[model samples]
Target: MEVHAHTHTPRKKWTHYFWEFLMLFLAVFCGFLAEYQLEHKIEKDKEKQYIHGLLEDLHEDTGTLSETINEFDGHLKRNDTLIKLLTSDAIKEHGSDLYYLGRRASRSVRLALHDFTIQQMKSSGGFRLIRNQKVSKAIIEYYNRTVFIDYLNGIESNESDEYRKMAIDIFHPVTFNGIVNPDNTIARPENNPPLLTYDSKTLLRLAGMVSYIRNTKQGLMKAEIEMKMAAIELIQLIKAEYHLN
Candidate 1:
């Protein structure tokens, strides 16, 4: 029998094969780690952009709010001037011009307030979030009452005492009776004796409207400032969370 020489190359050692397998595994793992890091960076960048955009939107909204407040303040100042003019002897004696001016000022104030209310609604999704329903309802009722006065003013003559009382009612709707304990029920003008009975019903209604406006203004201002602060805080949180700086 011829001696058959098996001249196959010696198989690699088990140790060498083990090392080669480990090297291949490590390479794949390294590639996977690099891909994961790249994807993570991309995601983070997208989030950063989103936060920056939101911050910009908040800033714009804040600006709009500030502008609205400024306009409202101006309207209030003008209304104050008109009130002074209405009370003056010269305007009262002269009659028609001052009466018209006063009426116009009152109308202007109400219109400005309406615009402000609309803006507030847009900014905060209505007063319900910042103020209680009772307060909001009071405000709406006051506005309706004022609108009624406006309607009456259009037809009624200014020289009548009824009109003068109505104007006073528009200005001073609330009166303080004896101060009471917190537990006691508050006394309002309607419950108290009427100072002017000729048009007491009309005057009382107008007084209530004015009182409602005054009370709601303070609450609205506080609520507005709080809303601004909340918006600013949210913006800061977004900046920090997304590393938007």
Candidate 2:
């Protein structure tokens, strides 16, 4: 019988086993670190994009606010003139001025905020990207003004509507139709227009309506100024914090 020699493989050393475990652990740790870094970079990129969009929105808001404010100014001045024409004793002689001022007074404007970035951030849960406490707070404050001013705008609309109704109550249909050209431009009658009513009470009631509209516009204009200031501060703060031009 041929005797086969018993050959046994040497057992792995304890240190060898430990080294193998260590290598695997290191590979997993490195992979975790790499993934974490990539996620961080992606978040940072998203943050940059959000800030850029917000900046654009804020600038547009500032411009719109400024223009709206000027429009309110014009509307208020014309309303004041309309009140004078309405209440004046010599109402028959003031037809041209009456038609011009009355038509202008009925016109109204409201602020349309440029809030696309803020809307996106709210919808997308992106407020987390605004890591700076000051920036976050300013953004909140600026948007809050929009909500408050919207309430004031509601009041403005109601007052303007009343004023317009008063106009229809007092002015003759022909005079009303004469003032508005086909293209909606004012065309004062060459002949002095006639009033449907000459009662003192009726004229005073219309004047009172004008006063209410003016009061609402006063509040709206003040709120707009405040919001515009907030927008400017927010813009500066964001630009400084992000080192953006």
Top candidate (lDDT): 2
Q: Which stretches of candidate 2 lie over 4 Å from their true place?
A: 1-6, 181-189
Q: How far is candidate 2 from the true structure (C-alpha RMSD, Å)?
A: 2.0
How well is each residue in 1-245 modelled by candidate 2, as lDDT tens digits?
99999999999999999999999999999999999999999988998998999999999999999999998888788888888888888888987777777766656678898888889999999989888889999899889887878897788788778887888877776778766878887776667777778889988998898888888887888999988998899999999998878
Residue 172 of model 1, lDDT score: 27
Clashes of each: 0, 0
* Positional deviation of residue 230's Cα in model 2 after best superposition, in angstroms: 1.2
lDDT of 1: 0.45
**Model 1: residues >4 Å from true position, as ranges?**
1-9, 71-198, 229-245
Q: After superposition, how far is residue 1 of candidate 2 from its true place, in Å?
A: 5.4
lDDT of 1 by residue, 38-124 (tens): 987766565444334445656765665466556446545544554454444454243333333333333221212223433444475
Question: lDDT at 159 for candidate 1?
Answer: 25
Per-model TM-score versus the true fold:
0.43, 0.91
Error of 2 at 106 (Å): 3.0
Worst 10 residues of 2 by lDDT: 99-108
